[model samples]
Target chain A: MTDLLPSPPPATRRPAPPGALSIGWARVALELRLFVRDPGQLVFSFAYPVVMLVIFGSIFADREVAPGVDFRQYFLAGIAATGIMLTSFQAVGLAITEERDRGDLVRLQTLGTPPLAYGIGKAGQVVLTTAVQLTVLLVVAATVYDVPMPDDAGRWLTFAWVAVLGVLAGTVLGIAVSSFVGSARAAGTGIPAVAIVLQFFSGVFFVFSELPGWMQQLAAVFPLKWMTQGMRSVFLPDAAKAAEPAGSWEHGTTAAVLAAWVIIGVVVCARSFRWRRNAG
Target chain B: MTTTHGAPALPAAASGERPAVQVRGLVKRYGGRAVVDGVDLDVRRGEVFALLGPNGAGKTTTVEILAGLRRRDGGSLEVLGEDPAGADRRWRDRVGVVGQSTGAGDALTVRETVDHYARYHATPQDSAELLDAVGLEGTARTRVDRLSGGQRRRLEVALGVQGRPELLFLDEPTTGLDPAARRQFWTLIEGLRDRGTTVLLTTHYLDEAAHLADRVGVIAGGRLVEVAAPGALGAGLRQEATVRWTEDGAAREVVTREPSAVLRDLLAAAPTGEIPDLSVTRPGLEDVYLRLVSEGASR
Candidate 1:
């Protein structure tokens, strides 16, 4: 059993680095710069939430609903939820889908960009956006409305976990939706359309308790309701729990519901991720 | 350049032991129809091989399969000594793929895009230098959205070669480029050849193939009908010369083997010793390509 065959030549290029940090971070830096180039987009995504808070504050000015609490204080938690969903789900979904339709994702595929790096970069963007988004909502609620800022360490700790979980829910849901929304035109209209509808159920503009039974059930199935409840746990006073749909912030249910969504979104995104438009 | 009729075109030949690419009985099916029906090809190291075909002749499909961007139904294919289907980031770093119409990162400046892409490679060419090489240095600060179609294609070329890949897959690289830019692209391709990079380009421009490719593969009906050096492709069926002349104020056509002798006889018969409105023609690579494709299609 003697065989003789010529071996191939050695490859000319050097071995690639272990991870995609160098490449992915470069993409992030480039996208960050691109984000700044369009002043309108920056203002719309980051500043619009504050504008929304002002409108809500003006409409609900100082009613003294819960001893010292007004309608604006009760409304603060819901608005914070809306801001999270807006940036993490709506903004990320639209941006990623646009990139996919325009073949930017495909281009990244050919350039040896590790698949996860794209996800990480996109998630990083959403995380960064949600930070600014939440900051503005908190600022307006505290400054204009004279809402109490939590000095208690336990309350602040609760706020931190809730925000992190809420952001995860939003970012993952955005990625999953990008798969379901195929073309640029559909993505452009579909994402915001879904957001507007979600707002009605999630109680961003009105009290979640006031919504009909069917609407409450529908809203409970989504992360936005849980996000709103979690924010209520952090911002609203103890007695304000009377207004919640579940008769309290339902902190345990808030953690379970958002965590469930995180798992579902990760599963859907795994199955639906398209490397190319024509790819089955 | 005086290679034998059967010899592969040596566009700054490489002395490497491995061929840049090899495929055997490659097949791809779309629903029921086999778009790439059993193709076999070999491109030597450092050779500029052009796959010339019509729109649906599966040139792009075959390139996609070789780039590992698509899966084949059945085939044994290799690029840079590895199966493209199983290629990793390391494998991708050693290659490049440019599509016919690519759109991405339109909001970034030319310099930013180039610099960003170069990060994927271990030791990529300098972004400024790559832009300069592709004639995009002047537009380095220009937004990609503002670049002309031709200019954007140049930027793609710059990005494609930034890795200094061992093999480059260009699917209609010059489609949107102007004539001057096309000439510049050819020069850039030649520079890649000097660096021992093997290029597999699919193009509709046969003249582009003729000018740049060391060898041309005319693919039609999902198969390669002919593969040869551009000069040798139509040498056989060429009934030699295509003679045209103005006879009694009307254009006339004839085919013959001995064009020089025919012209001399025409001059001898003419009283003016000048054959008015006469021209001699010979079959080119394009003629061979058309005949090969047409004949294949008819079959």
Candidate 2:
């Protein structure tokens, strides 16, 4: 073989193996750099939620969700939840669909990127982007819009776990659905439409209690609704609980629902996922 | 079908010259039609074997099977001595693929894209040098989407060699490159060959096969029709050359194998000792290829 390849295989393909952690980090670093370079994706993932918050926050300014809290604070929490979905689910779904269509996943497979490393690396992108997007939303809400920060240590703990659960559910769902999108261009329409549909029913843009009972039941079945309620529990004062359909945070249900979605995503992805070239 | 005689197929692993790739009775079906029907092939290590076929001729399908990128319905394939069907990372790491450039991560810069691919190999070639060799150093920071078709093909070549893999599969690697860039790419493949990398390539260009392949395989109707050295392909069909010249205020032409003897005879017979605008030509790979494909189509 050396006659065909002047260098020995041991020198090229067989050095001390890159441990799983290193390969994962390399993929994450590259994915993140690519995400940052695309201005359209940057604006959508980082700033779209803030832009939505500002527009709706002002329009609902005079309205009040509870005695002390106004629409701005109410929207602050819901929009933060929406930011997680946008950055994790929508962003990851679109990117993966496009990657699958473009043969990116296939190329990586051929290059021998370990499947675990690739999976972890993709999840890393979702986690990183959602973290940054949430930061941008919370910063703008607390600073520019006068939305109050969480004052209790336990509240921030809830926020952390909720964010993690929310992003996990969202990104896992994204990976599962990406296999169904037939082409890259089709993703532009499919992902945003699903997001919008979920947003409307999930009570991100409106009060969950005000929705019809059937819609509320439908919304309850989805992670976005639970994520929104979970974020509200972290940010809203106790009085705002009056506007929640359950009259309390329902923290147990939120965790259960999000965890269920995660399992469902994993199972569905295992069964139906098609990555790589079936190109004839 | 396109097996050309050069040296005998190099002795197998027992001879200290392993076959880089071997296929026996390979089969692949789509909706019950055989796309690749019972293909048997052998590519000796360090050899440049070009697979040539018209569209839908199973060339890509066979190459894909060899590269471990596709599954076969039946039959056996061994690449680097391991069946690609169950081949693992150790097998993949030694195989470099320059696939048809549907292109993934087009948003990544040329440098970034090549660099990411490099990490997959244990000891890749210098990313910077690879880019420069492909004439893409100027576009290193340019996103892949910004590259022209030719430039992207160059990037494909750059990444193909980045791994310094023992076996490289190049599928239509020069499809969109300009003549000069195609030549440049040929030079790069030659460099890889000289470095001892066994190459299995597929191309639509007969000239590319003529220029780069040690042996060329032609496929048609899901089976290999012939594999031969380029000069040997059309030899038996029409052995005569065409000699054309202007004489006596008119054009004249003759078909003969001995063009030089005819030229000598014509020069002696000419009153002015000249045959104007004279040329001697023979059939080439293209002629053989078109005949083979058309013959296959009719059959």
Candidate 3:
């Protein structure tokens, strides 16, 4: 049947796909470049948390959860956790919604972009930007608020895993929610509202021990609570552990919850992501 | 219902020619109403085929199904030797699509956007050459959001062809362009055709189809009313000429199969050698197209 037509030229023969890894890196580079070009997004993702930390850190400077464990240090940890979520969840959610609305995702799909590569590209942007945001937050906390860095290698290691897992979980969840959003405008307000409410529930803006027992239980079911606790474990003094709701840093639970979210978010994102708005 | 004489019979797959695209009984439904009722079409390799229709006429829907961007309720279809429903990345690599409403990433500059799309195909066209061909070289450094609508469209075309696909789908590609830019865009499509790319373009403009398509399909009311060479469409109607003349202080007109005979009779009746305000003209493609569309709608 194929022989009925004259043979097309050699170049017309189907070409093998450009390798997935290469495509993924290309997407990552492009996403990063775009992220940098949008000054509004840059300032919101990187600067908002730093600004919040300074304003709140100063208000609670002298209060201590325990002797030698300043309340400002505890607030610093929560602000850093929130910064990771801002960069990963909020940034990714808003970008995906806008892309879908603008038909950009449909354009990419038509070009035969590997779906995995596209996901990797978004996640890569989240990771890189979250890293930068985290660095700025940490630097500000240390220099301005006089919050000390994690002195031990183990504490630093904890910080690394928590941040990585928090970002991954947030990135995938962001993508998953992006599909359900009706438009970029909806996502702009909706995603941040969800983030802020989670912050309140997860004790980012309040002391976990002081929150109502039901709110603490409710917060335990979500990842942000674990992420905040994990951040506190790394940055706060060892004596501050007594002030935790569990009376100690629940490192094991934090790891399990964040990792589980990463897995669950990936599944949800894969199922929910759409190339076009209002697509069947 | 008004299939033209030049329309091909549904040939077997092993027949004389392997068409780049073939559809039979294509159907798409929205809330139980068939937006694309039943569409049958064929586009041979290395030829430019245009689908002409009015708004809500299913042109975009049909093209979307062909491009694998939308699903059909029922149909037997083939594009680039594969069913778009089951088409994979390999099939996609060979088929380029410039969707009617879909657009590229707006945050990236024109060159970067082109470069990004090029990475999806194994062998892509040179970015500089593509930009120049689409008349976007001067604006390559400008962010896509900053581009004028026509420039953005030119950029869309640049991305669509960057992959050098065997088949290209352009949906209303010249909708917003100035006449000069539209002509330039037509030239670029001609160049692609010269390189053996089979193009399936959809447009409401008769002149665009008449100028570029080797064959034009007139679709209306979710059905293909006719498929013929631009000049040959509604040929039977075009054969009859309309003759008009002034007589007895009134304008008189007659529709006839032979304008010469009518002119002869009118001249003989006139006392003067010259008939007053006389004209004999046949229907152009535009008239035929409008007639076809209106007829298709009524049916």
Q: Quick one: best TM-score, which candidate?
A: 3
Q: Could you give candidate 3's per-residue lDDT for residues A1-280 as a string of tens digits?
A: 1111112235446567787788999999988998898899889988998889878877876788668888878887888899888888888898888888878888887887777898899999999998999998888888887788988899999999999999999999988889887899999899999999999999888888889999999989988899999999998888889889888998998999999999999999778777888674
Report the lDDT tens digits of candidate 2 across residue range A97-152.
88887777777766767766776777898899888888988899889888888899
DockQ of candidate model 2: 0.29
lDDT of 2 at B160: 70
Q: What are the per-model DockQ values? A: 0.23, 0.29, 0.35
Quote each prediction's TM-score: 0.88, 0.87, 0.92
RMSD of 1: 7.0
For candidate 1, lDDT tens digit of each residue in B1-299? 12223323333325656577877778899998888988889899889999988889989999988887888887677677777777778888778888776666777889878877767777577776677677777999998999988888877777777776778899999886789979877887887776677889999788998999999988887898888888777667666779999888888887888888888888888858566779988876667778888886555
Per-residue CA lDDT of candidate 1, range A1-280, in tens? 0011111124653765447666567666766676767687689877887887788788778665566667787678778888888878887788878788777877877776786677777767667767877887788778877888777988888788788888888888898898888887899999999999988888777777778989989988999888877877787788878877768778888899889998998898888877676772
Superposition error at A221 for model 1 (Å): 1.3
lDDT of each: 0.78, 0.80, 0.85
Model 1 interface CAPRI class? acceptable
Which candidate, 1 or 3, would have the higher lDDT against the true structure?
3
Candidate number with the higher DockQ (1 or 3):
3
Off by over 4 Å in 2: A1-13, A16-20, A277-280, B1-16, B234-283
Q: Chain A of candidate 2 scores what in TM-score?
A: 0.92
Candidate 2 global CA lDDT score: 0.80
TM-scores of the candidates, chain A only? 0.90, 0.92, 0.94
